[model samples]
Target: MDIFVVDDERIIAETLAIILRNHGYSAETFFSAEHALASIGKSPRLLLTDFRMGRMSGIDLAMEAHSRIDCSVILFSSDLQECDREWQMLQKRDSRCTLLRKPLHPARLLQQVRLSLSTEPRLGLHVS
Candidate 1:
């Protein structure tokens, strides 16, 4: 499955992509939401994005991407409390949306990706 990693910080996005690639997944990296959105064709199997971006937030990216294709989104944020309301609202609208706190452990991120892309549909919110 294809995965897209979007982050304003180039290093973060690239590093994540490399990690996913090393794990045998086809992954791509984008430094901005606009770049990723413009490049998205059929939508990837998963989108791993940073919640707080300059022009477009991860939530915005997720919303737009969801409108175009059926895919799962995993949003990473440093301040989870600040986005709690928005996250809950997103969950109500899209059961496939999930939130992972920043400073993520590589193993946890991989686990979440697996769960999000699993054949068995996962319901409700996932915060880690």
Candidate 2:
């Protein structure tokens, strides 16, 4: 299963990708939503994106990608309260969407990833 990590901060995206890769998962990093969208054909099993970004927000990217593919989306934001409305709207649209706060703990991130994958069989992902 492939995991795509998107963050405007290059280090964050790359580090997340490396961590996922180290854990026996195939992963890639994208510094921009546009670039990630362009590569949607890769059909990532999961999307780990920063909620606030230049030009496009993570919710927007997830919505567009979910429209095209059946994948689980995990959005991270430093300011969670600011995106409450957006989160509610996304949940109404797709229950598969999940939120995680920024400055993520490695263990929590991995747990969420596994939980998301296990819970959403439509994503066609096998954890083991």
Give residue 42's lDDT in candidate 2 (0 to 100): 92
- Per-model TM-score versus the true fold: 0.94, 0.91
RMSD each, Å? 1.2, 4.5
Residue 114 displacement (Å), model 1: 0.8
The count of residue-pair clashes in candidate 2 stands at: 0
- lDDT tens readout by residue for model 1, 1-128: 48999999999998889888988889989999999899878479999999999899999999899999889999999999988888888887898988989887889889888888898987645575
Instruction: Enumerate residue pairs that collide in model 2.
Output: none
Question: Which 10 consecutive positions of candidate 1 have the poorest summed lDDT?
Answer: 119-128
lDDT of 2 by residue, 1-128 (tens): 47989999999999999889889889989999999999999999899999899999999999999999989989998888888888888888887778887788899889888877775343222111
Mark the regions of model 2 whose C-alpha exceeds 4 Å error after superposition. Answer: 119-128
TM-score of model 2 (CA atoms): 0.91
